[model samples]
Target chain A: MFKIAVEMLMHDKTKFLGLLIGVAFTAFLVTFAMGYFAGFMTRGFALVSENSSAKVWVMDPAVSSAEATINMSDSSLDSVRGVAGVEYATPLYLGDVTARYANGHFQSFQTIGVDDATLSGSPQPANLLHIPNSVIIDSGGTEGKLQTPLSKKDVWSYDGSHLQAPTRELRYGDVMLINSKRVVVAGVSHTIPRFPPRPLLYTTTSNFKRLIAGEKRYITFIMVRPVKNITPKELAKRISQKTHLKAITSDDFKKETVMWFMINSEDVGDMVNMVVLAMLVGFGVTGVMLYMFTYENLKQYAVLKAMGASAKQLGDMIFTQVFISAVVGSGIGIGIASLLAQIISSPTFPFRMMWFAPLIGFFGVIIVSMTAAFISLRPIKNMEPAIVFKL
Target chain B: MSKIIASCKDIIKTFNSGEAEVKALQGITLDVYENELLMLVGPSGCGKTTFVSVLSGLLSFNSGVCKLMGENISAMNDDELTTFRGKNIGFVFQAFNLLPSLSAIENVALPLTVASRKRAEILTLASEMLEAVGLSGKEDVKPSGLSGGEQQKVAIARALVHNPKFIICDEPTSSLDHKSGEIVMELLQKIIKEKGASMIVVTHDNRIYKYADRIVHMEDGKIIKVAS
Candidate 1:
């Protein structure tokens, strides 16, 4: 029966291709929308994802996601560090600053302040922290606004000695003004793109205070590591009791951030709308094409029915075709989507093809295809096998 | 008991099209006995096709006693009728009605496939039947790839492949040339006689009338004459 279904579909090359294309386009839209949404989710939790070593995060209760910058008293770090199950606690300073590059291009950046002694939360190695006025930049910014300028070939020159050489590019010793204070690029960090779509800059806590004045002690978050015997949830509970601040485990914090972004960000709403629109388009095309295909092959169905094929057998044949179309279309659609994701993938683009996203989309396509197949089966159900003689 | 494979007495079937009642088969009384080839000849819209449709258990008559192999067909539900039809009867159509997607052997093997026969055995049987119908080398060709005559031969093979007790061909040679028509009729007759199966062939081709064991002529939804 499945063989018959395939042969019937293949008998008319034009109709067969039309069905495939319809299903494929629907699959592509659904999968790509899911991938794009997943990408936004990844960026929304970039801070939490990057600091995966931290067991718990202590923040101002009002601060939700990486996009929300709520400053807490710097002394809150010591309170977390003093908890009985706490192994270590470090303050992470997050602030925004504008920097004018050597090309005189000024852009806003997410400046991260690392613990001076341990260089925790810093993109640079501990050894690189010794260089006074040193800073680390994200590679995502170097391609343009958010990428590291040190890696640009036309900008920097390699001198034979340790002394600074004449170069147009930002390098190990080049100075840039952040709030009238000069800072040097000592190292570079490669980081995934973030929600703000801004380049990342890392500096010591002292540098952060100097760059953004008006406060001597400001901490955005306290990254904590718990003792071996203590689970993150237990340690977070203790920290919250001691410091009167929100101390959430990594997983909870990730969920909190993603949820906050989903609720607060207008772009997220737009993205969700786009995903729904894509699904509607795919559903429309697939449903219409399958209905037309079944109607065109109604005579063939009549012949089968007249030849004593039971309703269940005929229904099974229709379902088999729909299932095959879904599987084939999803494979092709996912393949095309992955290719497109790869082609347009960049710091500025939000397209993340997660493994589970395509799996979910596959199921969605199956449901849509099956619904269409059922709609097409209605005419066959009512058809009297006697009509075969009329033809 | 007489060797009656199928019998219908005073069957009534009507079609209500847009408020106008049309009698397609008005009190049709007929019988097809075992091992006999019954040819029905009639002009267009004279109820020849409708009569066979009812006989094959496809169309339900409003009132009548229709029986096949000692079973009351009209009393059976749709599912039972379907099972009985699959096991006891076969059909061939005027247009060959070969599923355009399937090859010659696949079309011939459909009834057995529906019967849930083993694939290897059904294929072998289908091939043998196709060869018997003068389509030896054309087993793999689709209906579109075959000539009008070869397609009809595949249809004939399909009808006889299930080894049913009864076969019905509705104008099997209507679309073929005289030579092809004769070839089809001869094959049908030889196969029916060899298998000892009853056949009801509805056709208007006068050239093949001699091949029938008996001829029934119909007009305006009723049989008017019978010749043997």
Candidate 2:
């Protein structure tokens, strides 16, 4: 009977293909949207992820996430250093600065100023103390918007048109101006990409102040390492109580950052809407197609019923057909999505494939197919076997 | 006396249309004997089909007893009746009702498959039955590939594949030409004689009445006469 069901379903190639495509399209869109969402959430806390050695972060009470911050007075850093269970504390500066390339092209960059002595918040190769007035650029940006023009001639054509330049990546000894102050690219650091992609510059706190005019002498966050015997959670509690500021463990801070973005960002809402719409379309198309397929084959089902096929047998046959469609359609859809993810993934585009993406797609397709089968079961259940004589 | 293969006594069946009640079968009583080809001939809407459906347990009756192979069909639940039918009753329909997706042998194998017979045994039996119906080389051909006569032969093969005690054929020759109809009746008669099984054929075609061992005439949902 199951074999018969499969043969009947496959006999009409066009309808079978249509059903598969509907399911596959749904799976692909749902998976892609979910992967994009997961990617954004991961990149949301990239700053905290990079400075993993910092157990606790101290910021102003109004600061909700690492992306958005309020400046804290220099006394806060000193006060954090003096607190018990705090092994050492370093002041970190986070602000936006505009960099002018040699061709006079200006681009905005997010600047991170680690401590001059310890380089606490820097990415790998924290030897910034060896180089003076030099900054490290993120590798992601060096290949992207931060690439340097070879010469002024490359900025314009012979007709005086504003033609784009054929540029090269920023490398060591590349010079750029920040607030009229000259800075050399000391090294390129490979770091996780940020949410709203921006060129990154890592410099010492003193250099940051010189590069940005009229910048007050304040820090964005205090990165603290808890003493060996004390947990970061306990240390954060002590620091928060002592300074009357918001001090949280790095993990908690990452979750808080993601939550804040989920609530405040329209991008997340838009992605969620896309996922929901995809699921609805999947349900509607699959349901209608299965219903039509079953309706057209009701005569055959009646014949089987009159031939002494039990109701349970008929139900199993329908379920077998739906299960096959769901499993195969999901496989094809997720396979295509994985291939697309591989082809288009980049630092600028947030598309990370979490394990749950495929899982959600597979189970989501199953639910849709099963629901369709259930809906199609009604006519078969109410069918009179004696209709075989009439037809 | 020949063994009584099936019996129907004082059976009543009705249908409820909007604002009207249609009595399709009213007080139909008949007995089917082994090794006999019984034909129920009547005009359209005369309830011959309804009577056979009730006797075969494919339908329910409002009152009275219908038994097949000495088991009370009306006393059985739906599942029990279905199993009983699968094991004891065979059917050949006017349309030949072969699942278009399946080949000739597969269609012939349906009854045994419904009985959950072993796969190898089912194939062997289905193959033998198809060969017996003179569809030997056409085993793999779907119904669409066969002529009307060949398709009915396949339907007949399917009906007898499980060796049921009784066969119920409803207008088995209505869709065929006159020659094909004669051939189908001859095949059905030969097969029933060979197996010594009882049969109840409901048909309106008077041309094939000569093949029945006993003909039961029906009119207005009642059996009016029995002739041999």
Candidate 3:
């Protein structure tokens, strides 16, 4: 009977292919959407990830996320270091700045400043200190909007109007202007791309103050390392109590950042909508196709019933058909999604196939297949075996 | 006296159409004996098909005492009836009712499979039955590849594969030509004689009347005459 079920489903090549393709498409769409969402959330809290050595973060009470920060006064860093459980503490500065290329092409960038002595959160501390007036730019920024024109001929005209053409990739020794001061690109740092993708520049706290000029309260956060005996959560609690400021472990900070984006960003909402729509489409197409397949072969089922096949045998046959479709379809779909993810993902377009992406797709296919089987079973369950004589 | 293989007494089946009640079988009472070929001849819309369905336990009646192989089928639960039917009854249909996806041997093996026989034994028995039905070299051939006569032979092979005590055939020759119908009836008569099994064949075709040991005529929902 199980053999009969397989033969019946496979014998109709056209319908079998249609059902497989439908399930595959659903799995692919759901997996890709979920991977994209996971990648986006990961990058949303990239700052917390980069400073993984720091166990606790101290910030102004109102600052909820790393991307949107309120600057703390200079006294905050000293105050955090004074806490009993804090072993080491360093200041971090974050601000947005516009840089003008040598050819006068301007682009906005997110500037990050680590403590001058420790360079606590700098992606490339050695490179920052290797050159004078230097900053390390993220690799993604170098490939995208921050690419510098090769020469005046690349962008300039006599009338001061520029025609943009072939630009050179930003690399070592490239010069850009921040606040009317010259800053050299000392090195390229490969960092996780941020949401809303702004170019990144990393420098020392002293260099940042010198370049931007006249910002009295510049420290955005104070990164702290807890003592060997103290956990980060315990240290954070002590700091928050002692300083009257917001203090959280790095993991908690990352979570807070992701929550902020989930609440505030439309992109997350849009991705969730896409996932739901994919599931619905998967359910609709697979359900209709399975129901139609069963309906067309109803005479065969009636024949089996009249031939003394029990209701349980008939149910097993239907389930066998659905199980094959789901397993094979999900396999093909996840395979395609993995290939597509590899081909399309880049620093600029973030996509990571987290372990759960395939899990989501597989369970999603199962749910769709089971629902289809249930719908197709209704007609078979109620069909009278005597109808075989009539047909 | 030949053993009574099946008996039906005061069987009544009805259907609901909109607000009206349609009587499909009205008080059908009959006995089928071993080693006999019983044919139910009737016009269209008569109760022959419905009567056989009740006797085979493929259907339920509004009221009746239907027994097959000495068990009261109307009193049995669905599971018990299904098990009883699988073990005791065989069927051949007007349309042949062969599953198009399976080959000749698989179709013949369906009864044994339903009986939960071992796979090795099932294949050997199904192969032997197909060969006995004159489909020896065509065991792997699907029904679509076979002619009407050959398909009917396969259906007959399937009907006897499990050695059921009784066989129910619904218009088994209606879809075949004159020569094919003669061949089918001859084959059925020969097989029933060899196996010593009783059979109830429902048909409107008069061409196969010579093959029956007993002929029962029905009209409008009742048996009007029985000739033996």
Candidate 4:
């Protein structure tokens, strides 16, 4: 029966090709979307992921997203660092500040205040550890400009909030003049994202305290890394119990980040997957068309039935045909999806396609394929043996 | 008393196509004695085909007492009818009804395969039957590659493979040439004589009627004569 099943598919190559393309394309779609979603999702927590060196993030209970934060007293820092499972709690100060450049073009940048005690403390390419007056920015700087002079513009404008401006392009050792304070652009990095814009400024935690110019809270968030096999959840539970703030694991933060993106903003993860889903739906529609290829040939199925084939055997014929289409089409679809994903690769994209995505995609193809095959079988199942003798 | 292989009384079949009901068969009666060759002969639209289909357990009659080898066919459920048909009746169709994807021997061995026998065993049995049908050398060729007569011969081989008590041939030679048709008729006569199984052949081709030991004629739906 299997050999016959194989023969039925082989004997009709054109129909099989249609189904294969349909199934493979469907597989590619689902796989690509899931992969990108995974990849981009990981990036949403880049600040934490790049710095998961910290085991837990300490934030106010009302904080729903990474950007939505309230400060706890720097005094609470002592209690967090002193928790039983906690080896050390690094102080982090985060807030958005528009860095106005000398070029007159202003860009919104996030200022994270940290010292040598944390993971993001060390600047890549050039070290800013010794520069108490310096700040670090990503990949060149605003307008692909990096290693330029850093000078802060006016702070405490008419609104009484500290929104300082600096030079747009920052190269190493560049100095920036800010509101009543002088910040030297000591280090430049690439691809690390902050909340507001392309240019990120990292400075000493102490300087971050004095430069802010407003009544401050604790830290934007705390980054902690467990010493051993201690699960992040257990540690977070303990920390949450000890403090009045919420302590969340990095993975939980990642999920929250993705959910926040979905709810409040247009995340690249959702966009990429939405495109993939559209393609998969196209493949399903195409699969329905491919089924017509088999449906048109249903008279042949009736002939098989009249030849002493049981319902199972007849159904198997349709199954084998559908399976062939799924294997080929899914192969094509995933292959196309993967190739497309690779074609559009960048640090900002967070495009990640994995194997399981395609595996699940195959199930998708099989489901639609089987549905196509089964629906096609309706006409054949309704076939009457009485017609075999008809004129 | 000879074995009463099959009997039907007061059989009715109606088909609801659209808003109107088409009555194909009404009040038809039939009987086949053991080892007797019963032929259903009539013009077109005479319900000859419908009569055989219902008697073969492929169609359900609205009202009837239809029995195959004394088992009530009308009362049998679908699966029961299937099992009954598989055990007791074999069919031969005019268009040769061989699966095109399967080789000639595979076509002959289909009944055995449907019964869930091992391929090797069924193939061996099928080969023996093909040889019996004068098709000893053409076992591996599919139905499409064979001649009309050869295809019909394969169908005949399939019927006899199960050693059933009754054989149903529905226009088995209608699509064959005169020589091929004669060969099929002769083969059927020979097989019935050898196995002592009753058969009912529904056909309008009077040339094949000589092989029938008993002939029943029908028109519109009712049987007009039973000539012995």
> Which of 1 and 4 is ahead in TM-score?
1
Better of 1 and 3 by TM-score: 3
Name the TM-score of chain A in model 1.
0.85
Candidate 2's residue-wise lDDT over A1-391, tens digit each?
Answer: 8899899888878889988888788788778877888888888888998888999999999998988887988889989998999999999998888887765577888999989888888876778534888999884323467777766565423544332666777888888888888898988887988876667899988888778657565699999999999999999999999999889999999989988887888876776787788778876787677778888899898878777788888899899988898888889999998999999998767888989998998888888789889988899988767777776
lDDT of 4 by residue, B159-216 (tens): 9997888899988888898889999999999998899898999897999888889899
Tell me each candidate's RMSD, in Å, in order.
5.6, 4.9, 3.7, 5.4
Report the C-alpha lDDT of model 3 over A28-118, residue by residue, as the tens digit. 8778878888888888888888888999999999988887888999998888999998999998899888988766678888889877877
DockQ of predicted model 4: 0.29
Individual DockQ of the candidates? 0.58, 0.56, 0.63, 0.29
Name the regions of candidate 3 deviating beyond 4 angstroms. A52-64, A79-88, A98-108, A123-190, A210-217, A224-252, B1-3, B19-21
Candidate 3 docks at the CAPRI level of: medium
Clashing residue pairs, backbone N/CA/C < 3 A, model 2: none
- Candidate 1: RMSD to truth: 5.6
Which tens-of-lDDT digit does each residue in A1-391 have in candidate 4?
Answer: 6676676676656766665665665677677767766675555566776665776787777776675568878777777777777766777777666654443334556677775454354356434645676777664123553423243433223433333345244666555555646677776666544332355667777667666767657477776665576777888888888887788987788778767766766555457568666756866676677678777666556544544566777777778767776777777887887888788876656567756777776777777777788787776677675565564
Expressed as tens digits, the lDDT of each residue in B5-77 for candidate 3 is 9998988999889999989888989999999999999899898898888888888899979888889999998
The estimated TM-scores of all candidates read 0.85, 0.81, 0.87, 0.83
Q: State interface RMSD in Å for all models.
A: 1.0, 1.2, 1.1, 2.7
Off by over 4 Å in 2: A51-64, A70-90, A96-110, A118-193, A197-201, A209-219, A222-256, B1-3, B9-12, B16-23, B61-65, B218-226
Which stretches in model 1 have alpha-carbon errors above 4 Å?
A: A6-18, A97-109, A125-190, A199-201, A215-217, A228-234, A339-348, B19-21, B224-228
Model 4 CA deviation exceeding 4 Å by range? A1-11, A116-123, A129-133, A139-188, A192-199, A206-212, A228-231, A266-283, A286-348, A354-356, A362-391, B225-228
Clashes of each: 5, 0, 0, 42
CA lDDT of B214 in candidate 3? 96
